[model samples]
Target: MLVYLRLLKESLSFAINALRNNKLRTLLSLLGVTIGIFSIIAVLAAVDSLDRKISKDLSSLDKNTIYLMKYCFGPSEIPQWKREQFPNVKYDEYISLKNSLTNTDQVAYQFFVNKETIKYDSKTVSDVNIVPASNEIVEIEGLNVDNGRFYTESESNSGTAVIVLGYDIAEGLFGGSEPVGKSIRLYGQRFTVIGVIAKQGAGFFGDSNDTSVYIPTNFLRRMYGDNDAMTPVIVLKPVKGVDMDAYKAQVAQKLRAIRGMKAGEMDNFFINVLSGFTDFIDGILGQMNVVGWVISGFSLLVGGFGIANIMFVSVKERTNLIGIQKSLGAKNRFILFQFLFEAVILSVIGGIIGLLLVWGISLALTQLLDFEFVLSLGNILLGTGISAIIGLISGILPAISAANLDPVEAIRTGM
Candidate 1:
């Protein structure tokens, strides 16, 4: 063991000397490994960050949650014209589903509205997301009130002029002062701020509640009647441990009955499950992972070749030293181990620099954008392990040739 340690120390010293003496050649040889590590690790970190964000954004909502609406969340067999002809889901339908559907939890009516400006006295915010949803949305969407309270059933039914401000919205409109009970102007009407939502940094689709305000859907309907610009949706959260297929069938049947659709006519609305959307995103991410592997595999292959070539050159240059060492009673295994350790050490140095580059970029990106980028310890270990493997594989043949060289022949060839 002590002998192996001495060999390792000597190998490390040789690697450092090689790097210092042949700066350009060493860096050029390391470039492929560096780029390969950077490529693989960067892709992994990005995908991981995106996956984490998705989990965070959807954590409150059940994966089994369904949206009953005219619009499809993904591609549909139904043509665009037919979809456009399908009437927007009515509030009555939402009510019917809430009452009639089995294996259900909370049902909510939501309005998809255009960007609107909101005002609190002189302070104003534009292009803000206006979430006009039924009071039950609080339960269905798992919304938490940071201050005051979410709208009550009575307030929703009566279309009371109350609003819940998102965290950043409150900060923008009221600064340090409390926003609850304060009046805000939107849609040419005054709404008393009744609650504030917790700071939700970003939503699943780049939408954030931070710049949003929630009001009763009834209030919006009462104010504007029916406008083409506003589309209504029924959001449903099914009970856990239920037969999902049977539950969805029952929901479709109830809605078909409500819409008076003839048998075999096909229901006009789309039943989009949240799980399917997440699965679709997962598939895309999987493809990205595969692509990253393919692209980086080539780079790593090139890097391996580079290391092999460098090792061959190193063996050639050290033939005289090897001959001397063998003449002085050094074993073939020691010579082989020395070359192998030097190759691995050199490759690992390149990987470390690549990892440092990734870490720096991740830090910069997280600071510059709302999204957070992460480089986990597991990935760091993976990079280092991969580098070591590349070096070992690349150096094996050259090290064997060095080990097998006849001391007399090697010394004469060097001379």
Candidate 2:
């Protein structure tokens, strides 16, 4: 073991000397590897960060939750015109489903309404998201209340003039003062602030919980009377361990009977399952990863050739030293290991530089952009493993060639 360690130390010394002696050749060789590592790792890190952000944004809601609406989230057989012609999900259907739907944890009705301006005294905040939803949305969405409480079912059923403020909206209107129990004007009417939601950072989309205000769905219904612009949707959160296929089928059958659709006729509404949407997104991200690998693989291929070329040149330059070592009882394996060590050292150096670049860029992007960029330990290990593999593959042929050289012939050629 001690003898092997001494051999390894010598091989390392030779590897460093080769790199130091050939500055221009070493830089050119390292460039290809560095670029390859950078391209691959950067793409992977970016995609991973995006995926994490998506997961974080959606963490509160159940993936099995279903949205009953006129439109579908994924590709559908139904045409655009047919989807458009389909009637909007009604408040009555939401009520019916809530009471009658089996294997359901909770159900909610929400309106996709236009942005509204909120006013408290002289302070005015515009382009605020107006989420008029049923009280059950609190549980369905797993909303966290920092102050006061969410509106009760009675207030929602009665269409009371009560509102829940988002973190930013509350901060903007009241500043240091308490926002709960205060009256705010929205849609030219005063609403009592019932609760304030906990602070949530930026969402995957521009619209965040921090910039939204929740009101009772019935309040908007009494005023607008099922306006198409409001686009009512029924959200269903199924109980855990329920058979999703049967549950969705049961829902379709019930809705079909309610709408009085004839036999063999297709259901007008779409059942947009959250799990299906996430699966579709996962497919897209997987394709992106494949593309990144293919593109970066070309750079790595070039880098491998560069490393092989440098290794072969190093072997030729050290022919005299190799012959002397062999004459002094050095083994063929030592000659092979020497070149392999050099190749690996160069590749690893390039990879380390690439990793450093990625780390610096990740920090800058996280600070500058709204989205956070993470370089995970798994990815770092993956990058390092990839680098070392590239080294072994590139060094093998040259290492073998060095090992097989005739000591006397090599010494004469070098002289």
Best model per lDDT: 1
Whole-model lDDT values for every prediction: 0.90, 0.90
**Per-residue alpha-carbon lDDT of candidate 2 for residues 304-383, written as tens digits (9 for 90 to 100):** 99999999998898898889888898899988887887788888887888888999999998999877999999889988
User: What's the count of clashing pairs in each model shown?
Assistant: 0, 0
Give the clashing residue pairs of candidate 1, or none: none
lDDT of 1 by residue, 6-68 (tens): 999999999999999999999988988998998899889888888999999999889999999
What's the TM for model 1?
A: 0.98
Cα displacement (angstroms), candidate 1, residue 326, comes to 1.8
TM-score of each: 0.98, 0.97
- Alpha-carbon shift of residue 201 in model 1 (angstroms): 2.0
Judged by TM-score, which candidate is best? 1
